[model samples]
Every structure is written in structure tokens, then in C-alpha cells.
Target chain A: EAGVTQFPSHSVIEKGQTVTLRCDPISGHDNLYWYRRVMGKEIKFLLHFVKESKQDESGMPNNRFLAERTGGTYSTLKVQPAELEDSGVYFCASSQDGRVYGYTFGSGTRLTVV
Target chain B: LAKTTQPISMDSYEGQEVNITCSHNNIATNDYITWYQQFPSQGPRFIIQGYKTKVTNEVASLFIPADRKSSTLSLPRVSLSDTAVYYCLVGGLGTGGFKTIFGAGTRLFVKA
Candidate 1:
């Protein structure tokens, strides 16, 4: 089976612009997660979607960032008026079940805000 | 969530066994230990996870003591391709209760 896949391996945007990153999880996976890492920082969780419903979103940095999994299949993370701090690697991961199995991560989208 | 501490970096030979240890002194009763490997520009890939005792898979081995306060990830006869950043994360597997946090991770370098 194919692993989780992310779109636009690299993206460069100007500050104050908007950007959207996409992720397609493995087949039959119900747990999808979004994470990102800023420069010189560790990867941090953004949110999680269990099918079409969001299970957790406490890690979302601010109101400018939004994530949605409409069909519970693919997910999109949108950042409005992106700031310099928003530049980082955005990673999407999926797990068959919340427990007893490890998550599979995508290659990640490297966002650069200039 | 329990905080994990691991060596910042390690070096090993191409055909030598590499053991990376992570310490989680205040691990919760139901927390599981997980290890992930990340290449330069890729997201983390799960290597192994164990609650207690030893768990071995085709890729690597995860050893957790009885206390579950620490765990070791052992890669046998590592090759140059094994060089990557390894992260140890601890968390409960509940549906909506816990979140997985990634640390700086240990950077492994395999030399020929």
C-alpha cells in the first residue's frame, strides 16, 4: 500500500500571503494528523481528524491557521496572511487506529515565507 | 505526556549495532514508548513502539524496562542509509486525551 502523500513538496510565499497544504492518508485510515516544525524547532502537532470530525485542535497556533478534512479522506491546512514564523515543514500522518499501531507520515511540505 | 531526553547525536560504523537510549523519568502508567526515524527533508517514520519488555520487528528492536521510565532502540548492523534523526515520543493512546510531542531528536551518523 502507498504511504501517506503530501502535495507541493516545497512552497515559497511572501509574508501576508496565503498558502494551503494538502495531505492524502493511507487507505482505510481513520486517524489523520497535521504537524509542523519551525526552523531549529522540533515537530509540533497542529490538529487531528478522525474521519470528517476533528478530534483535537489544541495545537493550532493561531486563528490564521485552519485545517479541514471534509470527506475524512484528504486534509488541507490553510494559513491566511502567512507570517514569517509560518515557514516550516508541514507533515501529515495517518494511523489505522489511535492505539496499538504507529502512524505513517508523508514527505512533508517545506513552506518558506520570504 | 512524558518528556523524553536522548543524546543529541551518535556515530557508528556501517556494520555495527547502534543503540539509542531515551529517558522518560515521569512516564505515566499507560503511556507507550515510540521511536521515529526522519531523513533530511522527510517526515518521521515510526520505527517501533513498546509498552514494556522487549518488542522486536523486522526493522529494529524496542526495549523497555519494567518501570517504563526509559527505552532503547537497537538497530542491528546498521548501514549508511540508517543515518537519520531519531525521535522518542511518549504518550497515551487514547482517542482524544493525549498528544504526541516530538523532541529535538538524536541524529545518527553511520560511517563506512
Candidate 2:
């Protein structure tokens, strides 16, 4: 089975630009999650998706951030009007089942907002 | 989710066993201990996990004491590839809707 894969590997944008990060989870996996880590900070959860439905989104930092999982296979995190503080690593993870094991994370997309 | 405490860094020589301990004093009854390894610019990979007692895999070993307040991850005959950050996560199995948080993690440096 292929591990989780993310797109662009790295991205750079202006402070007011919009950025989108994509994640393709393992086949048949039903759970997808998004996390972010700012410089010198711990990795924090942003949201979770079970199938096409969002299971939890309480971790999202603000209204400018949006996450979506369409058809339950892939997920996308969009940051509109990205600020300088948004420059960090965005990670996407997926698990087959919540009870059986821990999640598998992608290489992460390094976003730098200038 | 329970908070975890681990060393900020550890150093070991190649072909030696390395043990990193994590403390979760307020761990609940259902929480499980899990460890992950992460390298620079890469995502974290699962190492080992256990509830109580000892669980050993081909890659590493997880030892959780009876109190469940603390656990240790043991890597046998580690090599330079094992130099990375290790994160200790404590959470319940079915605690739906709760997020797993990764702390600062213990940075392990392997010497030649």
C-alpha cells in the first residue's frame, strides 16, 4: 500500500495570496487528518475527515483556513489571504481505523508566506 | 488526551541501544502509549505502541509500566539512520473527536 502523498512539496506565496495544499491518503483508508507546525512550535491538528464528511474541525486556527475531503479519497487545505504567520509546514495524515493503529503522515508541504 | 514529557535531546553511539523515556503522569485508564520517529523535512513514522507491559517489534520495543504514567521506547543497535526526533503520544483508543498532539519530541543524535 502506498503511503500518504502530498503535492508541491514546498510552496511560497505573498502575504495576501491564497494557497492550497493537497493530500492523497492510502487506498481504502477512511480517515484523513490535517496538521500544521509553525517554526519552533509543536505540530497541531487542524481537522479530520471520515469519508467525505468532516469528523472534527475544532482545531482549525481561523476563518481563513478551510479543509475539504471530497469523495473521501483526497483532502485539500486552503489558506486564503495567507499571512506571514502562516508560513510553516502543513502535514496530512491518514489511518485505516482509529482503534487499530496510529496515523501515517505525508512528507508535508512547506509553505512560506512572505 | 494526556500531556507527555520527554527529554529534549539524547546522544548515543552507533551499534548501541538507545532508550528514551516519556512521562504522562495523568494518563487515564484507556490511554495507550505510542511513539513516532521523524526526520528532517519528513513526516513522522510509527515506531511502536503498547498499553501495558512490553511490546516488541522488528524495529523497536515499547515498555509501559503498570502505573501507565510513564513509558520507554527502546531501539536496539541503532545506526545513523536512527538519528531523528521521537515523539511520545498518549491517548485513548476510542476517544472520538479528540486530536493527537505531538510535543517538541526528543532529538536523538547518533555518533559514529
RMSD (Cα, Å) of model 1: 1.1
Flag regions of model 1 displaced more than 4 Å: none
Q: Which structure among the candidates has the greatest DockQ? A: 1
For model 2, residues B2-92, the per-residue Cα lDDT tens digits are 8999999999999999999999998888878899999999998988889999999999999988899999999999999999999999877
Error of 2 at A111 (Å): 0.3
Model 2: residues with Cα > 4 Å off, grouped in runs = none
Q: What lDDT is obtained when candidate 1 is compared to the true structure?
A: 0.91
Tens digit of per-residue lDDT, candidate 1, span B7-101: 99999999899999999999999888999999998889888988899999999999998988899999999999999999999989766525788
DockQ metric for all predictions? 0.68, 0.66
lDDT of 2 at A20: 95
**lDDT computed for candidate 2:** 0.91
What C-alpha lDDT do the candidate models reach, one value each?
0.91, 0.91
TM-score of each: 0.97, 0.97
